[model samples]
Target: MKKYVYPSEISGTIAAPSSKSVMQRAIAASLLAEGESRITNPSFCDDSLAAMRVAEGLGAAVEKKSDSVIIRGGINPVTDTLNCGESGLCIRMFTPIAALTGKRMVLTGEGSLTSRPVSGIEGALGQLGVSVKSNNTLLPIEVSSILKGGTAAIDGSMSSQFLTGLLMALPLAEKDSVIKVDNLKSREYIDITIDVLKKFGIRVDNHGYNEFKIPGRQKYTSTDIAVEGDWSGAAFLLCAGAIAGSVSVTGLNSESCQPDRAVITALRKCGAGVTVEKNVIHVKSGSLRGFEFDATECPDLFPPLAALAFYCKGETVIWGAGRLKHKESDRGAAIISEFKKIGGTVKIDKDCMIIRGSSLTGGLTDSHGDHRMAMACAIAAMGSSDAVEIDHAECINKSYNEFYDDMIKLGAEIK
Candidate 1:
């Protein structure tokens, strides 16, 4: 456990970390491309590393440098087992790609991922002519047979990643494929996948987030791509600035397609002093008023938005609680439970999360082994009357490993 206390006023500039979402998808695309793909500013977070490992297991040669990674693409299948290292994206995205080889491959991971649902993986892939067995929809899934591209009706309410895997895998099938998605949440993530695929020389036709048409027997052409800064991770920093003091975060793409970029809208609605200039976002402490937000598309914003709501006036209601059940934690409950320890009042009703702003009396809380929960508590603690202690603080490494160090650079106090 680590305890954190913050100075009343925090001020500085910090660069945002690379987006793991983009980096992981790029790694998968690189594995399917025929030649060497150069990825600049690659993320070294655990999740990104897991994707790299998965690529290598499937027979791609990965060379790592300080600032970039070189990947030579081919499905050589050097290993029969792929360890996803607790990253949900790695498991969901790579399982279908593995099935493309028509060989037995076991997909497993550590920690919460072992218990996370994979029925979507089994059901969706099974429909596409792949044999899959799982631990009652959990990890350690065994799959075989080459994927045959056809029509698959996928339930997208739970996650968009399953659709992403199908999109990435179907292009190589011998026949054309069509994906019909129902209630597709986080559609922007799928958009990111399509955008990355287009950059790698693959074509996918998306029809209003409902249906996707993919032509089979296509090849991924290698190219040099730069991974953008992560808005999901940077939202915590921007929230910290809103609640504690003024902070400027650089390197975030103002035109980023990342769903979590909606953080700025929430902050502005709550009366935070926010301004976007060039490639930087400046957030400063200001008088705040609670505002309503629908996080159906950008569910990752719930944590930081929840934390920011605690400092705003009146009650803030965030929609889309249904989207939180399968994340790193039951994030809706985790946010309500952890924030309660700090003297914040939060409640969930149906698909809505309600937060009543109040002064925080920082106290001990557990992260529920969730990265966003830990960072949310840490950021909320900054404006609290006392220090906050977070158990299993290291869980932040699953995504933003340098979270605390980045905060410290912007004048956060921790030990």
Candidate 2:
């Protein structure tokens, strides 16, 4: 249980963490490339690591150098059981991908991931000729018989990540296929997947997130892949800069299609002075007034936005709290319990979280083994009466493994 007592203000040049989302996707792409891929500036986060293990289990040879990963694809099933740790993306995305291979593999997970439903996977994989079995759609999935490659209509309103895995894995099938989706949400995340697939020499005919055409027997051609920075994790640092002090976060692309890129709008609305140029976003503290934000499309931004709202005047209401129920933690409940430890007000009204921000009374805080919670608490401690103490602080490794080290570089006091 590491604790941190962050100072009132932080002023420094902080390099934004690498995008775990991009890194995980790249690993999957590399596995399909059937060649050596040079992935530079990769994330060692737990989710990314889980994706790596999945690729390795599929027979790809992966080697790490300095900060780059060299993956040579072409794998045979190494084990019948795979662990996704606590990565929702890895599980939702990989369940379909693992079915691409006929070998029977059981997908099991630990922690909060265990509670997430996997029954949808059984249905989706079944449509593609894979036999699926689950305990009421929960973890410990048993998938067998390689997909026959045909039309599969999937329900996408739940999570776009499941579709991403299917798109990536379907290319290797013996026959072309189409995925008809209904109520597809997070269209931006699908765009991110398509962009990454294009980099690896794969193509998907996207019909506005509702329909996708995947040409079978296509190959994933590898190239020099450099993953972009993470807007999700960067949201926290940018908000910290807006609330505590001036910060220059280098390596975020403003033109990115990441759903959480909407964080910039939240910052600007909260009265944070910001400048975005190319891959850099600079933020400085200013008069933080409470602002209402709609985070339905980019639900991951809830925690960071909540942290930003903690410094705003009056009450801050962020919509889309209902989308947070099945995340790494029950983020809705976790936010309320943890934020209250730092002396703030958090209430759940239907589908929104209202945080009344002022001067925070910092004390012991818990991360609840959630990556966002750990970073959000650290960010909230910026203007706290006392340095905030964080428990289960190591959870940041799930996304930004170097988060604590980077926070230290910005002059945080962690003990």
Candidate 3:
């Protein structure tokens, strides 16, 4: 769905998308829960759907509704191999949970996730005594083991999803264990994991980002869960509001531990008029000043941050460029390339991206098959000479399936 967005000022209110990061973890917890569990505001994106399907395969009776899902837990492995679709998080997170059953399971995915590195999994699971077979950790991941849980030390510099998997699966083992991680990035995601596990009656001795201790033979209890609004997706809408006009986004908790919630902080630093109430986040266009942000724990914020940087009066610097290498595209580079095509100046030096604000001429931009990139381009339309012509724009379905339609509701000139 190639569409164009005319230069437009947007105003009004829109609800934030359900956090797929939260939703997927909720689904996994619900599946591990022993009884019927209902999750409100479940995400319906591609990655969320992949997690739902995995829940179904694992013996949970998953009923999807317009706003929620009922998961009757106790998985019975309906299929030999489970397809994780295009979600890197799903494959990595669910693989260890699958190992808990001591069943031989094959893991595969589509597109970038299939091509994304999985070398992290082979060694991590191997340390946990799970037998794995793979083509140098490039998909067709086969694992079977009794999963005698013990101490497994991991290098977490690459991704946090694998650690998320170990944390999820370790509790079900017959013996208590410890997972020692070094140089863990995305530690905010680990906070979410621990939060989800707590609701399911699992406790871990969290030694910051370095070590996690899990008690064995613990069974998860089913409970009602409410997914928080996604800061990653909301960052795009918030950018739309700040670049276009006054737009209010509801459903974000100001107290969220999710690192991407720092979008509000970055917005404040960029000089956007922002307000925080009980459950809603509000932002409006204002003269933005150049600001610096360390996105090491929230690399997903890069795209929207780039969009916001385009409207600033001077140069904006964002850290954590190294973490963008394994995303759908080289995200840091993709943001630079796409934004620069539309009259923005972007440069990469070491582990930072410098975006210089200017009068952007948004004639044409491409999403590079990255959903965040797609929304970033759409948000950049607020500063376009005319409507931004976006190619491969439909990739927004990866997280926010109704993004353009939602934008239309909030007065974005998207057609």
* Local distance difference test, each candidate: 0.93, 0.85, 0.88
Clashing residue pairs, backbone N/CA/C < 3 A, model 1: none
**By descending lDDT, how would the candidates be arranged?**
1, 3, 2
Alpha-carbon RMSD of each model: 0.9, 1.4, 1.0
- What are the per-residue Cα lDDT tens digits for candidate 2 across 162-279? 8888888888888899999988878898988999999998989998777899999888898778988899988888888887788888988899889898999999999999998878
| Model 3 whole-model lDDT (C-alpha atoms) | 0.88
Question: How many backbone clashes does every candidate have?
Answer: 0, 4, 6
Query: What tens digits encode model 3's per-residue C-alpha lDDT throughout 6-86?
Result: 788899988889999999999998998889999999899999999999878878899999988999998678986888988
User: What's the TM for model 2?
Assistant: 0.97
The total number of steric clashes, by the backbone 3 Å criterion, in model 1 comes to 0
Clash pairs for candidate 3 = 5-387, 5-388, 6-387, 7-386, 7-387, 58-75
The residue-by-residue lDDT of candidate 1 on 1-415, one tens digit each, is 5656553557999999899999999999999998999999899999999999999999999999999999999899999999999899999999999999999999999998998999988988888899999988887999998999899899998889989999999999988999999999888899899999999999999999999999999999999999999999999999999998999999999888899999999999999999999889999989999999999999999999999999999999999989999888989989988899889999999999999999999889999999999999989988899888999999899889889998888888887
Off by over 4 Å in 2: none
Off by more than 4 A, model 1? none
Assess candidate 1 and give its TM-score to the true structure: 0.98
